[model samples]
Target: MQEIIVSWSRRRADSPKTFTRRWKWTREDRARIEFYRTELAGCISSATFDAMLEGVNSESLLPFIFCYTVRLKDLDLGFVEAGLVARSWFCLGEGFENLRRVLGPGPRDEGFKYIEDEVEGEDTGYNDPDTEPDDIYVQEQFLTKQMPAGAEEEGALWFNVNIGAPGNYLPGLRGVIRLQSRSTIYQFPLTALSGWSAKYIAPLLFLPNLQELEVEGHATIGGLKDQFYYPLSIPLQLYKGLKSKVKRLSLVDGRMRVDDYDALAELTGNLEYLQIYHTYRYEELSPQEYASIASFFRKNNRSTLSLEEICINDIPGTDMVDVN
Candidate 1:
């Protein structure tokens, strides 16, 4: 058995473009252990890797395994790939078509049984697109019924989903919310419609076990066209549930109000890190607003709430704030 570690980056050292190529290794042992270490050390530093390896759930490891297989396809690492796919059956149920193709039919078919059972036994609404659109009440009922029993115990701890326009799948979100409770998730990251409306963001706040969260979207009501305008609804109360356990929070490319900051302070009293990037109506916070925000953090400081670091970027008058 031989172990191989590949450090790959989407960003090339000299070129601005992102590309992928097989790295040369002379090891001849058929069994291989591969590691996908990010070349951008700042993004996933050595300390972060150690923490993840020690504490992250099995579901969270799937993406790393997927990345390893992606970079090392030329090598004969079928057993390793098959084992990862089988272990991550539940997490890979939604999106792994490309991975399935890479693994090919033999190992992929064997792993398909778990997903097949889930698809067949769970509510038909997951597959049926013909369900009524306006009737959220009926949809919620179907969502509750469709969820697998005891799913909260075994669902993905790191819930990351990107919802696009025209075909925003509410049923899928509903199923996730119904199946996984706050106690079951460790990280919840979502990118959706411009504004952080109650309808869309509320379900995610309920994840009490979530330690890290990243919400990325425009806050303007009508999307990019109405960038200057405030969202129709910004429910601060939604942050109430998030206050207990979340340690790191990031808000990116969104319109945020003073009240939103206040709500955030209230939400994560024990937050260790906070990041706000391009987060104002005009995509830059004014000097006065920045002062107000700095003061807000100072005033709300609690002994229990030891905010270790804050990173503010693209805000007109402010530089980054890092407190060790």
Candidate 2:
């Protein structure tokens, strides 16, 4: 069996001054090599490419059979076999972006159908009843850069762009693109939280295969002293736009008004799990407000709601009490 072992990190003992040549691949490394060589090699070279194309029409299925990383210089036969893997996913340093640019235009130009349906006869187990959807990770900046030019036009807030458009390239090339549960973080700029959420977060709610979502708000361009703020209307708009597709939701490090609780109570009927941590800046909930929230969950108890988990925590200075 052919094997390729790569080790990018060096321990202090592996330094030049160590003088003793004790460096060797560990047992775990050998196992990884074997798995890649035997199982993954065949799957990538043939199966993954066909799956990606079929996924374009199947909204519930993800196109990627598996995700793996390879180096730019190492785009050998084996590397090309690993379809849909993000080049930046495994790069050792800063040059991955440049490599992405070099590789980007070719796939876009050939139009995702370049690979013929040679592997369609293979039993890739993509349709196994027990199979789970693949998880796609997308950074906030990456998501923003891909948004269509008039994405926010006509009060639509969010809608799917054409597959040929630069912003909508990923779905066309990779297929339905399901995101990983809890692992994928959807970040929005703290400086423009309301506007960003309106444009980007709205579309995410409609993703056909997305079941869980976690959103983090950070100030990439400013300091925390900036004290991010948004009206109750923003989150209300977000909750109103959410489809029944997502069963779990988490929001972190953002601010919403006290009245947003009414919106939350109205929106969470279809949710199975909900978590709000340090995301709201409202004053303490009045007795009536607390009762209203409790009533919403209590009313759903005898129904189909699998909403067994709910958490709400406020920032330190905010007088809001914890909700279970």
Find the candidate with the highest TM-score and give its number: 1
Candidate 1, 28-141: lDDT as tens digits: 211121242344232222332332332212333322332323222111111111112121232333222322222122211222223322432222223222332323223222
Report backbone clashes per prediction.
5, 2
Candidates in order, TM-scores: namely 0.35, 0.33
Candidate 2 least-lDDT 10 residues = 75-84
Whole-model lDDT per candidate: 0.33, 0.32
lDDT of 2 at 40: 38
Relative to the true structure, candidate 2 reaches a TM of 0.33
| Candidate achieving the largest lDDT | 1
Q: Candidate 1, residue 63: CA error in Å? A: 18
